[model samples]
Target: MTLRIHFTGEDLARTHIAPQPDVLWETMLSLYRLRRREQTLVFGEWKKTALGRVPGSVRMLTTLVPVRGYTVDFLTPRAEPGSVAGGMEALRRTTGERLRGDMAELLARHPGKRLPGWAERLAAGCPDALDALVGAVDGYFHACLSPYWPHVRAQVDRERARRARLLSAGGWEAVFSTLHPSARWSFPVLELSYPADHDIHLGGRGLLLQPSFFCRQTPITLRDPHLPPILVYPIEHDLDWARGQAPDRRTTLTGLLGATRTRVLETLAEGDCTTTELARRLGVPPSTASRQATTLREAGLVNSHRLGQAVLHTITDLGVAVLGGRWSGLIA
Candidate 1:
């Protein structure tokens, strides 16, 4: 079956890339991924590490987000630009009407389906139930994704850089065509491989393109078409990240590149960044970041490209060799 998303010219014009990964969306989607043993190369180690670490609170919460089909939207707020704390705050403020409506719709999808006691209570919009939901989400995120967050953010950033290149080359249509093997860009509609066939009309609301590290296989969207439109797709992974955090090689890098320069390289290695982004990350002045990026680019440790008004800087393959991961383990 195909999920057809119809877009208007206004929709296309207003469509925007999410500036950062949506924390709650990833958290909610991961519940499905954690239940099954799939994609061993990408998720095996992470699942193994998280299998035992999942807290009881989250385990109870998982009943609402089953292994497949129809998860409640109230559990995951809008993929706004902010921190996890911000997302949790949004969940905490979910109105009683919305809580009742979302859960009723979810249960309606599988008539006569019985949820756990707490989950049923959640459907009733009990205040305590919302509290429990927030707690469980916090526990799940901390246990499963917190440690690997930097790596997760890095993967999302890598996708952003790649999409930026595609946009620079061929515009929005190119982005939709190559978004994933399952997706096809055909004129006014974006078709996706999905379990169910349905139509989501943009109605000029536009769409938010959100890249997720934990999203696997197929892309997903909110079941309620009345809400703001969002497309959450899995991003390409770096197999090296599955090995867990390596021993710090900062000492070695500092010896070769000095403290600030070494930090610059490390930051770029994590994700491609504009000079302003690099500066913001490093807490340094823009001019200082630019100069350092120039030095690194001149030394062939980084590549700088003019994408629009910003110079996007990415670590070169040689720089990858120096930091070490995909090419080989830490530099000797």
Candidate 2:
């Protein structure tokens, strides 16, 4: 089945990519990965580590976020972007009517399922019940999500950078077309492969493209069409992302590209930047930064595009490979 998202010109114009991963969204989606045993190649190591010390929140979250179904939107209230504390505060502030409605809708989807007493109290807007829920989720996040968040944030940030490059080179159309293999851009409608068939018409509310580390397979959005639309999709992962430590072989890269060029590549890996910004960071003349960036571009290790007065440079896949010490000696 496909999830068809209809977009008007205003909607397209207003569409934007999130700067970072949403802590609440990723935390919620990770539960799906945890409950399911699939994707062992991608999530296996992290799962082993996370499950080693099971917090009570694990059991509670698993119940609410069923392995394959809808979860209450209140649990993932639109917080201050990527802040966990902000998300918890937003969650706590959820009105009783909204919580009850969201929880009821979630249970309706599951049919026979029933909330526990605490969950029931949560639906009734009981302060203590909400506090317990928040504490449990916070504990789970500290134990599981916090440990590997740097990796998660890096992956999401890289994906956001890639999308920005694509947007710079092409437009919203290009972004939608290349969003993922599972998605298709047909004029104003973006079609996504989803578990069920549905349509979300964005009546000028726009959409937020959220890159997630734990979200896998297909993209997902809120069940309620009235809510602010957000499409949470999994970004491509580094095989070593979930592994404990990232490889550090800057000395080897320095030997190959020299110290200045090596530093340029490393900086670009962090994000796309202009030659001026690069020069500022490198504390060199604009001409020098331009020359080094040109060399990296010539070697097929970087991608640069012009934007008004500044030239934007991004690290290509090969650049990343070379910088990360996973590159072969040959450039071509």
Candidate 3:
């Protein structure tokens, strides 16, 4: 299928909601500020004072990072295919029965129209074990972010009302009439979501509101910044690129693994280094360093070019993108 990608400038200009590029950048920065704060609370304070107080903060941090990384990885466009396929695969592997049940339910009576090709494939692939099949699908989605339909719907409703107020507030036309043209084109805000009954038509541009994070509810930093230098997108894009591969490479697990592997690749960007060198610098074990390197090589993060008796690793183009945050969801 041909996919229409709306780049930064053209999209915003067509919408006519022109705000200074600096203002837009600041808005993204604010979101990042919020995300950092949230991460601090979840990974730092809450874990230390609450959950970690009982279970152990280090373990909590370790577990949460992978989960957060998984969700972050799943949200980006590049990694989306993996999100779909890996989700299906994981459902098959983990909750085959539940997957089957959900699929049967979808086939019998879903809230929306007939299941899409991908969704149907997920259900029909494993015949008798409907529940398992369905569960995997359900779990894959739930694992990313709980479908906050209620939350998203509420936020969208509020935004719609607020927008109406803005339009009717009289300054609306004036704001657009003498607006800075660059402001409109330079910063595009694309909404990604799982397919829904309602679609948002911004000016004439159709936003791909895929099922992912509900921008309204997510802490602002999670929002996609129209431009880079202020926001990164590569990691997520890499994951998307990876997902577009054969089904074997899909999954949040792969995304998580890929992202972690990406980081290891970056460390090697300066030059090839031994696993021991990486472990010491990265503060991990020799085993972890070695395993991460192996994974990265497999995922095409880094390459092992033999140097004498020892093998040295260096980042590839993929590794550069990941380290630089060209793919938003992958590493960050």
Candidate 4:
């Protein structure tokens, strides 16, 4: 049986909460750096494991150059060599390279979903400036992945339909926002279908936004060799107290460890506390604390860096607003 689903572009646009272009740009760049850095840490940790070091040939092939063309490095050895171990290593390398490449391409092109008019205006102001900005923006796009993931899937499908059309499409950030009102970059609100039977996510009716990005075939098993299997974060009443320290609509934070993480943020709003201290207060292990902290830090919900030997976590202005639901106004 076939059933027709209807949803307008206006619907999808509304789900997005609009932040100023400059603010969005900065957030993207920061996210890019964090993702890159986090991946590197993960790679290093993996390398120390028995299965960590993939063969040198596989390693070379898997190494991807940022912003380079679509060619992945390590396909040859895996295809030709008759070594299963080598191929497995090659596949691991390939996974990282492919994920990074896709993410880079996504970032470089995604913002157009919200800022095509701004791009056009910039191009009109000074042609050379547009060229320079594209290069600068390309580097910055990586961080904004979480914010613009919805556009990444749609844009990719459009490109696959034809080759020349894809190359000449400028970038995702240049065209995705085409449906928006040119006068203001605000997006139309959108709805998402959370299907019970299958993994189909229909946003704005049939509009599919990055299905693969959300597809997780494997179980989430925490197996950190360096730390315990689980760590806990403290819970509090007001996470917003920390967020109140930042500007409105300046940052966006979204992640998976919601229940425990949200509670920790709410508790912190009362005042600052260390991970161990917070864990004691919340009744969770130290490992859970570490992972959630890392996730929160990457999402821009919390700020953390080395303070001597200890890492201090604090909610930023964006975090405060998110906990308080102050960002509802920015959504279409």
Best by lDDT: 2
lDDT of each: 0.79, 0.81, 0.36, 0.34
Question: lDDT order of candidates, best first?
Answer: 2, 1, 3, 4
Residue 63's lDDT within candidate 2 is 68
Model 3 regions more than 4 Å off? 1-137, 140-148, 167-332
Best by TM-score: 2
**Can you write out model 2's per-residue Cα lDDT over 123-218, one digit (the tens) per residue?**
899999888888878888999899788777777877787888778756886678666677788878999899889889999989999988889889
lDDT of 4 by residue, 1-332 (tens): 11122235643443221111122222222222232434332222322331322222222122222222222222212121223333333433334333344434434544442323433333234444334433333333332332343333332222232112211342222223222122112233221222111122234432322111111121111111111111111111122221222233323332534578876775555544467756877888967776777777787777553333445455543456566444322211
Candidate 2 displacement at residue 170 in angstroms: 0.4
TM-score of each: 0.75, 0.77, 0.22, 0.23
Q: Residue 300 in candidate 4 has what lDDT?
A: 74
Q: Which TM-score value belongs to model 2?
A: 0.77
Candidate 2 clash pair list = none
RMSD of 2: 6.8
What would you estimate as the lDDT of candidate 3?
Answer: 0.36
Error of 2 at 193 (Å): 0.5
lDDT of 1 by residue, 75-163 (tens): 77783563889889988999888888888887888778787888778777888988988988988899888888877776686677777
Model 1 lDDT, full chain set: 0.79
